[model samples]
Target: MPLSARRLVLIAAACILVGILAGRFLFEGLILAAAGIAVLAVALSYGPGSRWFSPVTWVVCVAGTLWTAATAGYWMSVSAAADAAQEVPAVASTLFYIGVGGLVIMAGGVVTAAVLRTLGVRRISSAGG
Candidate 1:
């Protein structure tokens, strides 16, 4: 796999970890740890001749993105609903920021992948230099 492909995969996996952590309401340390594992998995999968073209991989990537976005939406909605009860703005603000970040990441990944695929990849000759 190319570096770009690897990075893409890692990003997708990271989204998955974020989704899982958010849904589980895990502590910060565990969430970070899970995200790290996802990043490592993605990076390690990036090697020449690696079978990264499976349909299941694509399914997982798409599902992960959707899951992340949905999870973010859930958190944001809950926070908004509780705004009347809590005087502290920090909690709601932080949750909103995280949700926005997740949405941005998901959108960026989809757009980037689509653009790259539509443009297509070309090979450069290594024998010249």
Candidate 2:
């Protein structure tokens, strides 16, 4: 995998770890991890320039973004409820941050790749020219 993909995978793995250890939000973590793994696999097999890579990323990105937004909305509603508890689980906060962080990593990877290419920094490319 390219460096960008590898870094994103690491972030995804962290999300899985957070869910497992926290015993909460496992579904969300698994979704992010699976998407990350798929992205990495697609990038490696077809190369970043191949037609398959961007579509895979787009599908996963959209799904993950929607899921994250729904989760955030649910959290907001619960916190706003009349009977809402005063204290929130620390793990819940961590998991939320990790999910958002994974998204950021994905986006950052794309931007980094584009910037590097634009700047003639293909040395970081998997081809290693």
Candidate 3:
């Protein structure tokens, strides 16, 4: 894909917004938040033109989103189990489910992103040729 100034700005804006949201929920300390912002800023700065950005973005996005989902799932499961069985098995179940679900979600996200990227490449190639 052709890297345009407009696209770069849009990607930067998106990365900044996502980084802020991730920081708000995932980070407990100011340093971590700052790190997140810095990482995102770099991603945005290099994304539009860099060959590595698309894959890196896809990997990070998929991993981050799945991590978020997994943590959320684990908390929810633990809450439900604590309310229900009050047993060690229930706690284990909660952990297992959360871990498995997170993995599945992460893999799914990667596959989905790969498909989208493939389609994008196809479209661009078709347009050019």
Best by TM-score: 2
- The global C-alpha lDDT for each of the candidates, from Candidate 1 onward, is 0.48, 0.51, 0.51
lDDT of 3 by residue, 1-129 (tens): 335424645565665566567756654332233334333333442333346466545554555454555554555666566779765345556656655664554455545545666777788899999
Clash pairs, model 3 backbone? none
Instruction: Write model 2 residue lDDT over 73-115, tens digit each, in one string.
Output: 4455445552575566555566566556656655555555455
Residue ranges of candidate 1 with Cα displaced over 4 Å: 9-51, 86-129
lDDT of 1: 0.48
Q: How many clashing pairs per prediction, in order?
A: 1, 0, 0
Q: Which is better, 1 or 2, measured by TM-score? A: 2
lDDT of 2: 0.51
Clashing pairs in 1: 1-47
* Regions of model 3 farther than 4 Å from truth: 1-88
Cα RMSD (Å) between model 3 and the true structure?
A: 9.4
lDDT of 1 by residue, 2-66 (tens): 66666766675776577556656743434444344434433333323345443433433544444
Displacement of the residue 79 alpha carbon in candidate 3, Å: 21
